[model samples]
Target: MSLPSTFDPSRALSLARETLDIEAQAVAAMALRLDQRFVAALELVLKSRGRVVVMGMGKSGHIGRKIAATLASTGTPAMFVHPAEASHGDLGMITADDVVLGISNSGESEELTAILPLIKRMGVPLLAITGRGDSTLGRHADVVLDASVEKEACPHNLAPTASTTAQLAMGDALAVALLDARGFKADDFARSHPGGSLGRKLLTHVSDVMRSGDAVPRVPREAGLMDLMREISAKGLGMSAIVDADNRVLGIFTDGDLRRLIERTGSSADLRALSARDVMHPNPRTVRAEALAVEAAGLMEASRITSVLVVDELGRLSGALNSNDLMRAKVI
Candidate 1:
């Protein structure tokens, strides 16, 4: 479409801002609508023996799908079902043990209304989220959630704008309430979102990514500068663990230590008299082998360093990791 002849940039921005403000106010008003019925709905879903089956039509259907997904990911078992499909045998998916969450802006979606009787017959609890409490769907529902909005963000007040925003907020409110009641934690969320980056950070342990056994660069505490330098260079870890006879880490000699050593000595000959202990940093940061990879990244970032040693229960070096390893694991 070509630009309108009367188009004005200032007017366009003002209209967009007005739409956002209207939607924001609509969502804010929903907080005040939380009543005894809201708690009743929460308790119904909380005590439900089976999954939450969400249903709706049109834009409300889209919002319903999102609500079901959020609830499922946050520890509540939920699935979205099309109201139109429910009349065509999909209604069989609902059991008496399940809870049905129906969404409709006017509380009069015909597709949804078609199956309301069947859902009621199944003895399933129905939670209606609508703008009208006396609406057919609301009156027949076991519990009603008021999602009415004063007005829509639409200039003509025809589109589902503020009403949909209000519904979405209420859906989020329900999911969060269930989340807290279930005592759902980050680890549980990560499990549900296993394909995402957050799952990698939360579930990937340091031991899974760290280089262990011979892969770790180690030199005896009595080892010379040449041996330490060889170990560091061969491992390409920018550092080498200087350990004692018992394989207990005594110190770490890093590239930074090499720089300081060179600056102090001013010649290669000065390095000949130095052993690993003389130039090694005695206080090195360590992480437990079972720690989350993200936690290791946190330590590395906070210390402004690129790597950390992974220690066993005995405080002996078991593995090693650097920023490169974390990057390879996609944990950073």
Candidate 2:
């Protein structure tokens, strides 16, 4: 890396701070400006039978794409249609049932203005987020959200900086309000984003990751210590459930238990003589298979245990899972 001879670090830092201050003030001003118009916009979108069709040009076009995505993920059906594309055959994408949200910093993008009349003619309600309510886009809009910023963060006031920030803030406000009105929840968001970490945590259940049947380590109550140890080693769960003939869990034996037993009895104790019933801890913590994997994770953390046994409604041993299972499933 290298710096030019004219580079001044302090000047760069001062300008960066000023830019943030300007953008922050713009967003704050917008909040104070909200009124019945914003509410009307929300009602319009909520009442629509079709999607919210977002349209913009250039920098606004980029912001529109993001707003559309946010609305879609948060339970509102929305999509972005570039104004220039709408001028072409893409105008057909807008239906009478849809609500059109046009975004422009100056409210005077040539491509956007050219399509306003066409959108109005389609009988779709128009909503505008722009700096000038007197501008052509605003005049055609049924609801106008005043996103006007006093100035751009750029020193020359030529870049889209602060104005774009205000536009983004407006988009976020709409998405959040609409989500609340529609009763959209974290689970709904998770369904739209199944590949994300939050989706895995909310959607994965204990039954999906637990080891069951022959994969679960278990031994009869009368099993000797050697038999219990073999079951643990073979299943690789580091624990074995002591069950009755009917498969009801009687107790649990783990590596932690074995260590504690060794500490109490010392090396002189005859380990080979002990049976599963003699070594197991009774009334172990267990979770149902249908419970969320995160719940099992919570139980393990709260109890300071590494694994938990899964049981059916009748309290029979059904499965087993440990920290490793949660880790592999990315639920931890």
Candidate 3:
């Protein structure tokens, strides 16, 4: 692990690339090994009445934690149980209806094997992820997924490199298979990851966060610029919607227009002599109430505007939204 006085860029890059290629090849091979056993494991987890209890030791344990999380977040009930802890009463987490998934490259982790007999006695189904189907863990499993790899990505072939990668890919395949089987949708995913960016993007609709009702600034088209300015100031949107007699949106008057008009006419009082229709920009960029808030952010950024109107299906103003709304919703 000594640092060289001078680094050789090409040699360093080639070593990294070789390691990646080896692991990639390992994952590619594991895909070919998928068979009926994989399907059986998927069904076993899907049909279980209780949660999926994931168990593993060492490197397999790290992979198990992620697998459990993926399963739980993707509409399946699952959790990771450390095999060592299970031996010391953590087995209480395992219910009779739960399905136990044990992972080990050799399929013979002593901590896991020790509890296999008791789990079987409890009548809970056992699923195994292992490199060797004939290993003790695999033999005892109700269903076995072959997660074998040709060789380790380690240069000396002593590390758990390629094998762990295959295990991860296998776990992903299981999660996705069960996810599709359950017909999980984006809303369901958002419920699990409510605090993440993906959740905000999927679950936060324009109507949910928009400033609606009387809070939206609106004035008749015949209203004077002074009236519009007052509405904008009262509503704090920095803009006012000019609606026709039918309450349909006619145009929008923003602070940008006020700034430009003041610069052109050289006086603030002179600009107020005009009507709303005289100074408003017609056909402002708008979004529907049902659209996602992130879409509103996109519209604002792409058009180089700070605010936009929320309109109904028939072009009636339903609400107002601005860059600030997006920022508050964490959609920015």
Ranking by TM-score: 1, 2, 3
TM for candidate 2 is 0.92
Report how far off residue 211 is in candidate 1 (Å).
0.3
> RMSD of each candidate?
1.3, 2.0, 2.8
| Ten contiguous residues minimizing lDDT sum, candidate 1 | 264-273
- Cα lDDT computed for each candidate against the true fold: 0.92, 0.96, 0.91
Q: What's the lDDT for candidate 3?
A: 0.91
Tens-digit lDDT string for candidate 1 (16-125): 99999999988888898789999999999999989999999999999999999999999999999999988888998998999999999888999999888888888899
TM-score of 3: 0.89
- Once model 3 is optimally superposed onto the true structure by TM-score, how far is the C-alpha of residue 324 displaced, in angstroms? 1.4
Model 1 residue 220 lDDT score: 93
lDDT: which is higher, 2 or 3? Answer: 2
lDDT of 2 by residue, 212-239 (tens): 9899999999999989999999999989
Best by TM-score: 1
lDDT of model 1 at residue 255?
93
Every model's TM-score = 0.97, 0.92, 0.89
